[model samples]
Target: MTLFFLNILLAVIWATLWNSFTLLTLAGGFALGFAALWLARGLLAPHYFRAVPAVLALAGFFIVELVKSCILVARDCIAPRPNIHPAIVRMPLDVRSDAEIFLLANLITLTPGTLTLDVAADRSFLLIHAIYATDEAALVAELKAGMEHRVRKVFGT
Candidate 1:
């Protein structure tokens, strides 16, 4: 949580320095601080800095998927005949730590039409409910290529 605290501190400092304590100013400051920390990775923590880009990629990917999922679900609602093949797919995991797995699960769950039901006891697999799971293999491949892959890449350092 130090990073988050540091971000807040930087925002506050920025407001104090600029003499304008608006939400937009604080947000700009936080973003500036994040950029500063990311650029100064060699002096600070390398792993955290390395994860920033991956985290950003994941965030962008998530936003895109979220929008797509929302549109899909909305189309289903509007259509006279909805054609959704819902299923619970058991997917194997290769992420190293619990935090990685948790983040992956949360990312999946946060997106529409998908829910992370549970994680295997060994942390080797996750049970996910998907609304568009027409084929298990295709869904698994998609997950592997998208969320799972990005999560592993983010924490691989």
Candidate 2:
């Protein structure tokens, strides 16, 4: 967390030095700060550096999933006979914290053809409504391996 704050400070300083407080300039500063921190990572706690890549990977993975979902949903909509096999699947939860669960639920809901219906009262699982859940087991496995796994990484859980 300290490293994160330091990075942000560096970015702000860079923005001030450049005499432009625009988003682009700030982002460029952040990138440079990240590079500097990464290079000097041996002096700092290792986890923070690892987290940067993990967050980036999660973002990239989410974007890919979002695009694929959009395409699939669009195709189903355009078809004379849509092939979707909708189902509400109970996905067992590995993420325990409220923040983790909240993020996972929101990400699932943000996808094109999926919605997070409800979380189990015990917080042991999530009820997900999927538009293409012909194979419920596969859907659960995919979510477990993909989004849940990435969320865990981001939180270091």
Candidate 3:
């Protein structure tokens, strides 16, 4: 019963905020579908009140790093010195779960200048393409420090 209500409430909020569903009928349909899934699967409810603060902290950190990446890219473009140090570094991820690995890869791709190229055959490593690579150590450190750690925390690893 609680999960059903929670799903309906979530659907209503989503419909309201996005304004994609103009008619109450459509909103009710969405709520019903979501409620059915919620009831059938019995997914563990995330404690949103506890998750909100951590989410905000992660968002804030990403914003600061985004700014730094933007500035660096701009400087490299303007310097006329060919500052593009292109390199592919394989970051061996400690995170074993699929969700955590996907989160890490998505985080890498979401950042301004980096691209997640591929995962290893065993899924133990991620191939990341970076425009600036001072060294292997720097690349590894940057990935571990910049994205992976935060994702591990955010996804409750």
TM-score each candidate: 0.85, 0.90, 0.66
Quote model 3's TM-score: 0.66
| Candidate 1 error regions (>4 Å) | 1-4, 34-40
Ranking by lDDT: 2, 1, 3
The whole-model lDDT of each prediction reads: 0.87, 0.95, 0.74
lDDT by residue (tens digit), candidate 2, 57-138 = 9999999999999999999999999999999999999999999999999999999999999999999999999999989999
Candidate 1, 1-157: lDDT as tens digits: 4665776899899999999999999999988998888777677766665666788898899899999999999999999999899999999987859899889999999988889999999888999999899998999889889998999878863
**lDDT accuracy of residue 26 in candidate 3:** 56
The model with the greater lDDT, 1 or 3, is 1
lDDT by residue (tens digit), candidate 3, 46-137:
54333445666778888888888889888887896957888888899878788878877887788777889998878889999998886977
State the weakest 10-residue window (summed lDDT) of model 1.
43-52
- Ordered list by TM-score, greatest first: 2, 1, 3
Better of 1 and 3 by TM-score: 1
- Top candidate, metric lDDT: 2
